[model samples]
Target: MHLDPRLSFLSGPSVMAQLMRDKDWSDSAVGPPQEWPQALRSVVNLLLGSAFPMFVAWGPQLAQLYNDAYLEIMGAKHPGGLGRPLLENWAEIRQDVGPLAEQAMQGHSRYLENLPLRMRRGRGEGEEDTWFTFSYSPVQDESGAVAGMFCACIETTRTVLAERDLRARSEWLQTLFDQAPGFAAVLRGPEHVFAQVNEAYRNLVGGRDLIGRSVADALPEVVNQGFVGWLDAVYRTGEPFIGRAVPAVISRSTGEPPYEAFIDFMYQPLRDAAGRVDGIFVQGHDVTEQHRSREALRQADRQKDEFLATLAHELRNPLAPIRSATYLLRSPAAPAEARNRATEILARQVDHMARLLDDLMDISRITQRRLVLKRERLTVAAAVESALEAGRPLLEAKRHRLQTNVVDPDACLDADPLRLTQVLSNLLNNASKYTDPGGRIAVDARQSGDSIVFTVSDTGIGLSESAIRTMFTMFAQEQTALERSEGGLGIGLALAKGLVELHGGRISASSEGPGLGSRFVVELPAAPAPVAATAASPAAASAAARPRTVLLADDNSDAAEALAELLRLEGHVVHTAAHGLQAAEMAVALRPDVIVLDIGMPGLNGYEVAQRIRAQAWGAKPLLVAATGWGQEGDRQKATAAGFDRHLTKPFDPQRLVDLVGES
Candidate 1:
């Protein structure tokens, strides 16, 4: 019964050759192979009938067989794989693949896709990494008994890894595109139609629904400006374009006006693997606010330069005439009468010019934080009286009637007496300048709790609501169609407000309307100490008492001469000097009660002059008064530290000059 070794090997080959020949015959004409043993013939028939090339192995009752296609699919392991368990021949597939084989042996068919097999082949010296989609199906004998599994498979690892890598790349791109702050968009096709837009791009396009729309349809204006054509050119040529500071205006369906935006952006073409342009990507950032702020700052700088230039030009015009008149007056051969007349004219015009300059300087100091208050204890009544006396000429020139209702005359406050007087004088002067002839101006003060309220009201043209709102702003002016007169520089109220704030007080303006009147109220904290009985009458009592000799020195000869003349008229002997040397000689010879020295002099300055005078071994030392344009706190401290008894700013009131010179 044993077959020869040659015959056994020939048997499998011959059966496979016969089956291939039967492939050309009809299925009905081909009967199953009967001459072979049932076990061997059953295995051969099962292999030939399988949908896929397969191999199977069985024990005792059945025979194992492998098809020609299976021999080719397995390569070198063909005949040797027969008559063996499938897992034993492919041992590396045992872990996850064992159940499939068991299911097939238990009379069921099993299919697995992408089943990884790490098999060691007899190729070269090492194992090869290969993947397979394998299936295991049960085989049956002639009596319909189950046999071992037939294994079928195909390799599929390349496609799986490629799909996974593509998915990861897609997710990363989507995340980055969504989180970008600037606008981003994709335009597809030859027409540059919008394929996708990020959140920022959607907002930039006026928040309209724009996907799938052509660039021309979404923004017709952009098409008119050739922006769409530019994008098309980039897409067609596959060339990148970059633009910076491209000005653009966007109009939305909403009623808002078209807003301006400066755009810096790039257009990059999306190309296929062969480098054919398919789409375009746009990225842009908005720089509107930066542009506007820069423009505004530039305009402000230009205005500031123009204002300073104009101020210098205007000031020099008046100074030229005063200088010419002073040179004539100081000539050796000049007649007394002519000299006096020339001096008077020079003094008047110079005083006017100096007032304007002082106002301008005050405005500058207030704006630059250089102005300071010299605070002291003072009566509100005295401040009001001083302001009235200082502003009497203006009121008289306008023929205005002045009234007073200062009930709390003894109420004293801690304030800068000079600044308080300046504030009141500015208010009075403004009233007189705006009021008509014969109009009434009133100065009133009263006590309100721990504070005193001083009001300067005038029967002048009232302010409109708009005017009142900007009344205290620098450079603001009231508009009057009936009167074409030039108004003040509009810095007085602003300066007053700054000074009041420095003293921890408040000042405000009010009016009924254009024709009624205007009133300014100043409220200040009263002094903590009780009011003195002599406070109400101190100024008057002091003014009537005495006249003293005074020496006035200033680099501005017109100012010094005018002040000396005014002091002489007020019953004080006054000597004038155009320089510090003349005044120093006079001060030592006369031993004057007070020496008013100008801080800014040619040779010897006020500080050095005062020091020299104080160092002299004289019987009665003169009171050193620093008369200078410098009125800051540090300037006052410098004067005091230099042995100056008092500091007086330029363009000071003539009566105040007299009072400081001991005329009251």
Candidate 2:
């Protein structure tokens, strides 16, 4: 192509410049370069020579001209857009760029950074967002009047989008920090000013607004407790501090006294880019409840050790006297009076030991919820009389004066008569043991409104406040002198409390002070509308005695032989078996009228023996009795299920056993 001399400046290695040189500009808004003014020519030459993105919008029609660097921004509009007006090529962005171009033509320079534009730039895609940093300067004519606007620009889409994504990620991380499980906070500077705190931190301190406040001012109660000093240490040394179950007195509410709390926490120093410590990050859990639970477990373990020691001492105390009594009885030269005295001592100590065992068993039953109450309607006076009978020996031995004031002897109660008697007896026995010899003890029972109240007041060694607080706890005992060590196994009152509560009643004790006497009060709800009672039929007369064969089975030889002798004295022929297999064999051979079997036996258990016995044709003729130490309700049910007629615990009354055989 032969280029015209007037358009020689358009001769270059640039694609846009080469395109301009070959075009005919006769119909364009700006005429050919041959007739173009000096200012437009100079600006166009400058636009084509630059390596940076640059463009020119000239004349009233805004004819467009741009360097090769600006072609990328034009996208699909390139080549065809070389000679078009600025609005024609970029009409989608007219609202944004129109004013800038107009200002430039009026002799003012206009600059914009990251100006957003939505225009078609791809070949087949729809209009999309774009960004640019560009400036527009006026190109003056030879007469000094503005004729066009020159724009220098660069696309900033990638940079702007990157910054936007970074901000979004930062917000997501902030949300996660706020929702952390434990309390968290950030403190800034040497003063430890609160910079940020999570939701848990807010709740830990009772929702106080803590931002911008120093640690010492916000938590004044903790200032003297060494927490502030710890924070200062962490910030100064840039070292972390960890604490477990650390104690602090914190005021969780306005105008409230401070309460103690234990926390597991850490203070970590935060560092800046230069590695200099700038702040401290606090994170922790309120572990007060867990700490208390652990301490309670430790205390309970200590109490258990003490209780075991006391039990051993109490059990051994009676052994020496019993052994002495047995030795005295074995001597033939002992006189009648001496023999009777030894026998009496034996009886007394055996009774004392039996009572202790009973209390221990009762405590176990109550704890296991297996103690079923046999509830019945009875009079308060009847219960009081039974209790006094059981407690008379101790009261007489102590020479204590007993005064009974049953103002309402007829006050009725819907309770287990046996358990009620036990409760009253425990209190009476406790009084007799603690009271000095010849002290006065009073028992008062009265009906008060819808309840029955029983008060047992005694002139005794009164209770201390510490003892009063824990006296009803199991295995809890008063700190008494060695002389008062005979105060029983501390389990009596604990058992009493459990029994009373089972009947929907409450028991409490009060004392004026040590040596001023103590009073125990028991209040039970009165029987709701009393149920009418049917007249009791006279007891059935004892059946005429019949000489029937009885089979007795027990692993304990003495127990089996003794029971066999008792049955013989009742005019029944009795045979003894030392184990379950022998008892089963004997039952088959004798075809006895009654069989007393121990539930726990060698060779075969009582349940299996009973099952085998019932399988025989002759088994239905004999009455089966289960006697063993297992006495829970479930045990009775099991015995019955195994074809036994009755269940009896060990140490059952001998008279009852004889009566059972006679009835058979």
Clash counts per candidate, in order, are 0, 0
For candidate 2, what is the lDDT? 0.86
Tens-digit lDDT track of model 1 for 307-332: 46546655676678788778877798
Weakest 10 consecutive residues of candidate 2 by summed lDDT? 535-544
- Pick the lDDT winner: 2
For candidate 1, give the lDDT of residue 158: 74
| Model 1 residue 99 CA deviation in Å | 7.4
The weakest ten consecutive residues by lDDT in model 1 span 23-32
Give a tens-digit lDDT track for model 2, residues 259-341: 88899999999999999999999999889899999987887787788778877887777777899888999999999898899
